[model samples]
Target: MPSCQPLNRMKKVLTAQAEAEKIRRIGEAEAGSIEAIGKAEAEKMRLKAEAYQHYGEAAKTALVLEALPKIAGKVAAPLAQTSEIVILSRDGSRVTGEVNRLLAELPVSVNALTGVDLMKIPFLQKMTNPQA
Candidate 1:
């Protein structure tokens, strides 16, 4: 019976050691997955940063140009909801022309807000003035 007790104790010790080794392996695997995820995220950010650096102001201008109509729509959204409007003017005035003028002013507004002068962009300059 005394010898049997020692064998049982040995078996318990081996079981505990096996459990500890399993836990260590799981911890190491979890750490490796976390490291891989971190590396992938870092790589994604690095690529994005490089792309932004490469695109530079051209991307900004394109984004602004793309967004201009949306911005104008937002600015004029309240007016769109109006059922009717009465304007009294001594001179002949057209609301349509006023709306067009307001839309035209968006680039200037964008320039003021973002400090990215749409007029300065070569493509925009070419668009505005073909001779220049």
Candidate 2:
């Protein structure tokens, strides 16, 4: 019975060691998952930059065109809730002018905010005038 006591104590110690190793492995897996997520995000950004460099201004212009509809929808979203919009001016030109003004200002506002004038960019300049 005394010899059995030592054997039982040794089994308990081994079991405890195994549990500690399992917990450490789980923690390492969770840490690895977090690191993998960060790496994936960085990879996505790198691909986007590579695409921009490869496609140049044409790609930028295409992206702008694709975004225009979404941007227009957002810009006009406020009017969606309006029950009625009363134009004080008798002339119909006021409504046309307002719509035109909003459309015209969209590009200007985007340029001002982003500080990226596509026209002035070297890629765009080269694209517009091949001789340059």
Candidate 3:
């Protein structure tokens, strides 16, 4: 009986140690799974934030593109109107000088003239030929 008691005690200790090892392994696995899930969630958030920032920049570019034509039209209308004025000087050089002076007095920058051909006008011949 005394030898049987020692064997029984040894069996109980071995069983308890095995159970404790199993519990430890299960706890470690659960902790690892939780950490992996947290990492995945953090990555997902980072990607979403980057996408939103890019979307905002794209929207701003679209807005600027949409407004460009209207802004250009507003700036060009006055210059177009000023080019229609006819200068009635006897000398062609004087008429050209008067046109330049009028253009310089305008509020906006006028680099080029458009909408009319000076050669097509009947009065330009008399202006160019002062003796006639």
Candidate 4:
């Protein structure tokens, strides 16, 4: 053989260089994909916010009414997952009281979160004071 050693070394160097180039290309493709996904998500959020801004008070009230049950479901989800609830007191009334308090707090929490006073709404006002 003329010089098989030099040929083998050169082949190894070429293979390593090709692998490095492939890795760099893959990294750049992944970065581009990530950037595109981020931009898409940002655009979606912007459009959603714009749509929300277009909603009238009546639509917003309807939206809140629809959301109330979902919010209650979320609040009650933890209890659903639990096998049993332990009451430290002699009677289980404490637990019932707490549950009642949580239900009572929902409207206050919703008002604080949405800036819509649930009490002032005409529908709720009529429901609360039906004679009026």
Candidate 3: Cα lDDT at 129: 58
Off by over 4 Å in 4: 86-101
RMSD of each: 7.5, 7.0, 21.9, 3.1
Compose the digit string of candidate 1's lDDT tens values, residues 9-124. Answer: 99999999999999999999999999999999999999988887788777878877888789878988999889999887666567667877986786688889877898888887
Better of 1 and 4 by lDDT: 4
- Kindly indicate the candidate among 3 and 4 with the higher TM-score: 4
Tens-place lDDT digits, model 3, residues 14-83: 9999999999999999999999999999999999887757765446445544564686799887888684
Measured with C-alpha atoms, the lDDT of residue 126 in candidate 1 is 93
lDDT of every model, 2 decimals: 0.85, 0.79, 0.66, 0.87
Which candidate leads the pack in lDDT? Answer: 4
In the range 1-132, model 2's lDDT, one tens digit per residue, is 357888899999999999999999999999999999999999999999887888866567667767767987998899999999767888889889998897656657767755446566567568656877
After superposition, candidate 2 runs with Cα above 4 Å error: 1-27, 113-132
Q: On residues 11-128, what C-alpha lDDT tens digit does candidate 4 reach at each position? A: 9999999999999999999999999999999999999899989998878888888888898799889999899876688778988998889866766889998877787787777876
lDDT of 3 at 74: 91
Candidate 3 backbone overlaps, count: 0
Question: After superposing candidate 3, which stretches have Cα over 4 Å from the reference?
Answer: 57-132
Lowest summed lDDT window (length 10), candidate 2: 113-122
